[model samples]
Target: MRSQVITGGPFTGRHMLIVIVAFFAVVIGVNVTMAVLASTSWSGLVVENTYVASQEFNGKAAAMRAMASSGISGDLLLRRDVIQYDIHNRDGSPAVVDDVTLTFRRPVGDREDFALALTKTSEGHFEAKHRIEGGDWIVETVSRRDGVTVMHEARRIDTAEFGQ
Candidate 1:
């Protein structure tokens, strides 16, 4: 019987080249997608004037401290489609304000940022109807009396913590 010689089975040079190209194609595609997403997500500017903001940081901190010392505080509750806000005074009484503005900013991108005006329900309780998606968010509450802002508070909240 004559022995048969195997030239090529499945490991040809062309097949190797195809596998390498496919691997690199996937890597390059993922890298490009990530780069585009990161670039568009952030504006790369935290403040318009860093030096000016830094200089005024102390004053801002002092103001915030004073607001807190005066027993001015706020509680924010995130429900399904509504946000409940309650402001309190030094005596644990409801702090009545003319208007309240709630700003919801996405931690990752500004595309999901939104603002809503809260309607006063009672003495110090305000409610705003807004649909908040499940994610991390930066909530900014601005309380104004007589059209002048009295208290400004910002905090980060995770939707998962609230059973979103």
Candidate 2:
């Protein structure tokens, strides 16, 4: 017996329709999932007002430059039960500052963000008794002398275990 030639292998208009619908369904499903995750994870707000931030950019840049030229720097320490920062001069000696304030923020979100006012422990060493959660952090430190801002520093750090 001779084999009969097939007109349609199996794919039909119905199959084509299903295939197109399934492809789009998958794409739309993935897009919705991604959008939800993104919206929940981060607010995506860098500044409250872009225009205001832009207006002050130049002055902030100048202040930062002046701070850098002054050769003043600070070191931050995160321990299990305390947070510490030490300021130094260009000559490596302790730089005396009136106040040291720290703002700890998450890399992506502001839910767990907090600020601490460090008490001067010694000449240039400031300490704050706050156990920061262990994770990635962006720490902003501001050192002031007689109500004048001396140094402004922002740094990223990862901690294995803090306040544990």
Candidate 3:
């Protein structure tokens, strides 16, 4: 019985090359998959409403920060008579706020979410025709600017009719 090792040009160094290539393919594939899962918007997983996104919230945050940092003041006025709420971009130019959603838990009812597309009425004024029952509500606004979103919320006593 005899054991012999044969070294050949076609099969000798090629095995190492083949193994390297295969390993790289596997590594690249796994990395790509992980990147997609990890980088893809994590916002959707935060809630059950698959169709809704928090883009507006990001914009609201930018707006809020910009509003704060710029020393440029703006207001969310919940009008006394109409219970009408208004938001001002007030950042000097048109902002990329796509949507504004108001979610609230009334003084007595279960939490409910209402949404409306905000339209810029003027340089910094964004308006929407929304009417709601009066109550102490926690408001959250979802806004999008430059591919990012923000949810800005303000709390208030809808006292326009609370005492009535």
Better of 1 and 2 by lDDT: 2
Name the runs in model 3 displaced over 4 angstroms.
1-74, 79-99, 111-113, 159-164
Best-to-worst ranking by lDDT = 2, 1, 3
Going through the candidates in the order shown, the clash numbers are 0, 0, 14
Per-residue lDDT of candidate 1, residues 83-113 (tens digit): 8999989788999798989999887778888
TM-score of 1: 0.77
- Per lDDT, the best of the predicted structures is 2
Per-residue lDDT over 1-164 for candidate 2, one digit per residue giving the tens place of the 0 to 100 score: 99989675688899999999999999999999999999998999999999999999999999999999999999887887888899999999999799999999999978999999999989999998987787899999999999999999998888863434
Model 3 lDDT, full chain set? 0.54
lDDT of each: 0.89, 0.92, 0.54
Name the candidate that leads on TM-score. Answer: 2
lDDT by residue for model 3 over 103-139, one digit each (tens)?
A: 5545343434455555656543565556655656655
Task: Give the TM-score (vs. native) of candidate 3.
Answer: 0.40
Alpha-carbon shift of residue 112 in model 3 (angstroms)? 4.9
The predicted structure with the larger TM-score, 1 or 2, is 2
